[model samples]
Target chain A: MLPPALSDKQTVPFDDRGLAYGDGLFETVLLRAGAPVLWRYHTDRLAKGCRRLNIPLPCQAALDATWQGDCTAELEVLKLILTRGSGGRGYAQPDEVTPRLLSRRTPFQPSIQRWQQGVTVRLCDLRLSRQPRLAGIKHLNRLENVLARQEWSDAAIAEGLLADSEGRVIEATSMNIFWLQAGQVFTPLVDQCGVAGTLRAGLIDQGVVAQRALLLDRLAEVERLWVANSVQGVWPVTTLLAADGSLLQRWAVSDSDPFQRLAHQLLGFA
Target chain B: MLPPALSDKQTVPFDDRGLAYGDGLFETVLLRAGAPVLWRYHTDRLAKGCRRLNIPLPCQAALDATWQGDCTAELEVLKLILTRGSGGRGYAQPDEVTPRLLSRRTPFQPSIQRWQQGVTVRLCDLRLSRQPRLAGIKHLNRLENVLARQEWSDAAIAEGLLADSEGRVIEATSMNIFWLQAGQVFTPLVDQCGVAGTLRAGLIDQGVVAQRALLLDRLAEVERLWVANSVQGVWPVTTLLAADGSLLQRWAVSDSDPFQRLAHQLLGFA
Candidate 1:
């Protein structure tokens, strides 16, 4: 059969293993200036996820073609999903598996307000499960994040920070986190758990950020903190709150923060 | 829409949360002689799962109607899926969430031989993550099971047993496991991990089986072991092998195995 028309998101069979078992990987790309921002980092992570999950990566054309739509919007979101295809005998994957790809574009509602003024973050009571094999890969098994995200509905709270089962601060509900302490920047190691965001990877790749085993207690000790992802850029977290809404730490976000400037330089964004 | 026709599985949107982030729950029930076996157990689990995930469960009419059809085949499998219906701002659930239901039926090929002449089982290297909130829900986030099931291709091996990250034996890739020792029956506690099977519940609820924390190393000490589920019935396990095919334990399954007899009476299978 021909590849689905660029618009038919209906091609995914209800039996697609992604729907059946979440046997898939996904990448939400920032399509700015008609091209995906940090495309290579997204590709690298997707490839790594596919390799780890044993789901074949789609051909380069199929991957590239997902973002070929009109560039009318300066900034948009490209949500890409690739599953271990339509047929599988229960949890036993098909012997000859073909991966299915689905992409959806939504207008990017830039969180510049959150980025400029910074945002209040909360400590989620729900801790993330540790699965090193499934960690770092943006696989579809994200109930932990969903549950954590639902912890608070207060509009002022922009993100919820998650800790691993062992009390190690992992990441925010939707983004990877990095903190500066005495001039050195560090993000939690995703090898044990958590999605390693493309922006986080770009920073690590550029040697500006380092990954370390970050315990939850260390969050209170950090000088400055920020949450970031491929779609929303960098969000300086000015306030941290306990689940009970008690104050933990508060900081003044600078307009010319070093990480924000570096992130802008890497993505070539205004 | 009128809750989809009993047959239109296609109504599941491609972006349904189940497919997007494993945000769903499922139950596979046994349809024997035009009726579902252990129906109440399945319903109880489904309701519990939906409540925990905050996915709205369909009313009695919609839930019951999913299986309103001719069950010509004496023994068949009914796969029921309930996903948090489409559309949400990423992982933050929609304020008003309606769940989508999908059911499919296939002939249940009874593993008489595996049941009568105990089948061999293998240990899996892929350890399950510990998430108490997700434990026992039988949610759609099942990549761990898929990965474990893929570990072996030997048709001789009927199942693979899984251990949680804490090195505790949780369950088989597709079934819950029970063992007999000194005339006492025990199964693993699924409070930290594993799907608590309907059949396992039947045994436990009957007060015939005891639940305890079973570690991976303890499996070798059992006198007789069996893996069971609602659809496949009960299969006596004769030999257990490590992931690398090293022998761990073996047992002579009896025609008058006490657990098998009780399970048969509980399931009411001829």
Candidate 2:
């Protein structure tokens, strides 16, 4: 018999390891036309993360059945979090482990004006720590991202780019970034840190970009810059600034950024 | 009016950020005869963690009322967790944030034999990342400790010692470690990584030990080693080993260990 199906407005047990120690993995999926987008990429990452963290994969049948939840909206975000279930008050896993899958919904709304005109970003003083074990996968322990995102409260700054302790640009606070230089597209490698975003994966699979380590200083010479994620699709970065608002790199936006146009076509983002 | 009182075996709302991004802090206190051990240290750390993270402190009146929750056992463990409650999508804090207070209890049964006879420990392959924003406080983003603690399953080895990526000796999987050299006790400073445990703070407050940065190679020259926490009291270290089980340092436990005897008195750990 299968375990319980996903329910709406449910309460998490206080004993969940997800709350206790962040011992889990999560996927934020964009649902359009009552179905999940980039499902294969999401599943691949989920399977990979569960394997690496030794959390048993939830039943595929049960997971698939939850897609038809009472979502009548044309577009929405569905969050799938798989925790290592409840364990006693310690870090050690019990002899028997049962993974808990929790799904929640939120209304999806992306700013068309920001995507069209492009947006500005600033360098975050907070540096992401390098941990190869948790490098590419999106795990529940995202205090670094939270801390980095909170560095700015201004609505003018769309995102904050985070570099590692060694001065390598890993990713933005909540998205993966790419740059075009010499007619070649490059994205930072996640080998040392940063989440290997599904949108980045899809772009690489389509051969639209190549993976290379980019340092914070090298961003100045790039011809064009863009940030992409599953939810917000892709956005052109107009200006990149240091922590003190000193301009580091500037770019012009037109109807003609080849990489940005390609992302719009691929993700069906108008 | 005061907030709702803590309930045993309760449920956490699905939107709690404690599970979402590991955005919170926790303190584990030993309840002896319905009185919390190290109450002042626990509150001090909790208040400091909240101030740093900007999470509001819970009502002290409500907190004190819950400490007597049907706990009849002479010794038990009470875990108090404070989380940023019910956030919408993304990392930005809500304009009006309500912190959630979750408390649970467990049976406390420290190994008398292990505490008296001492225990063996091995170096963990997983090194703690250095994040000063997260250092010293016992936050909910503990994936590093979870990974380090799962490295060994042998009951013979009671704990795993963790060092920072810079090779600075930091702490153990679940406790703070101290070493004595030339009649001076020193513990690795928590400014870079590791939790500033309540027991460790108590020891420092009593002038029993001083803080110092230690390299992993320096463990060999230490005269004696011990690990301490609120729940388990203290345990003497008999041997320290490398990840491959190679002996790195050895020590002899004696009943006349002044440090151990003092901790026993402070914590009332028989």
lDDT of each: 0.86, 0.85
Estimated TM-score for each candidate? 0.97, 0.96
Mark the regions of model 2 whose C-alpha exceeds 4 Å error after superposition.
A1-9, B1-9
Best by DockQ: 2
Q: Write the per-residue lDDT of candidate 1 for residues A64-157, one digit (tens) a residue.
A: 9889968768888899888888786789988888777888877776766887999999999999999988999999999999889889999899
Per-residue lDDT, model 1, residue A77, is 88
Q: Find the 10 residues in a row with the least total lDDT in model 1 chain A.
A: A1-10
Per-residue alpha-carbon lDDT of candidate 2 for residues A5-99, written as tens digits (9 for 90 to 100)? 34355567878898899888889988887688888898889988988788887767766665766776878888888788887438998877777
> Residue-wise lDDT of candidate 1 within B1-270, one digit each (tens)?
235233374546666888899999998988887678898899999989988898877776777776668886888888888888777888998887777788877877777888799899999999999999999988999999988988999989999999999899999999999988788899999998999999999999999899988878888998888999887778998999999999998888786887888887877765
Candidate 1 residue pairs that clash: none
TM-score of chain B of 2: 0.95
- In model 2, what is the error at residue B226, expressed in angstroms? 0.8
DockQ of each: 0.76, 0.77
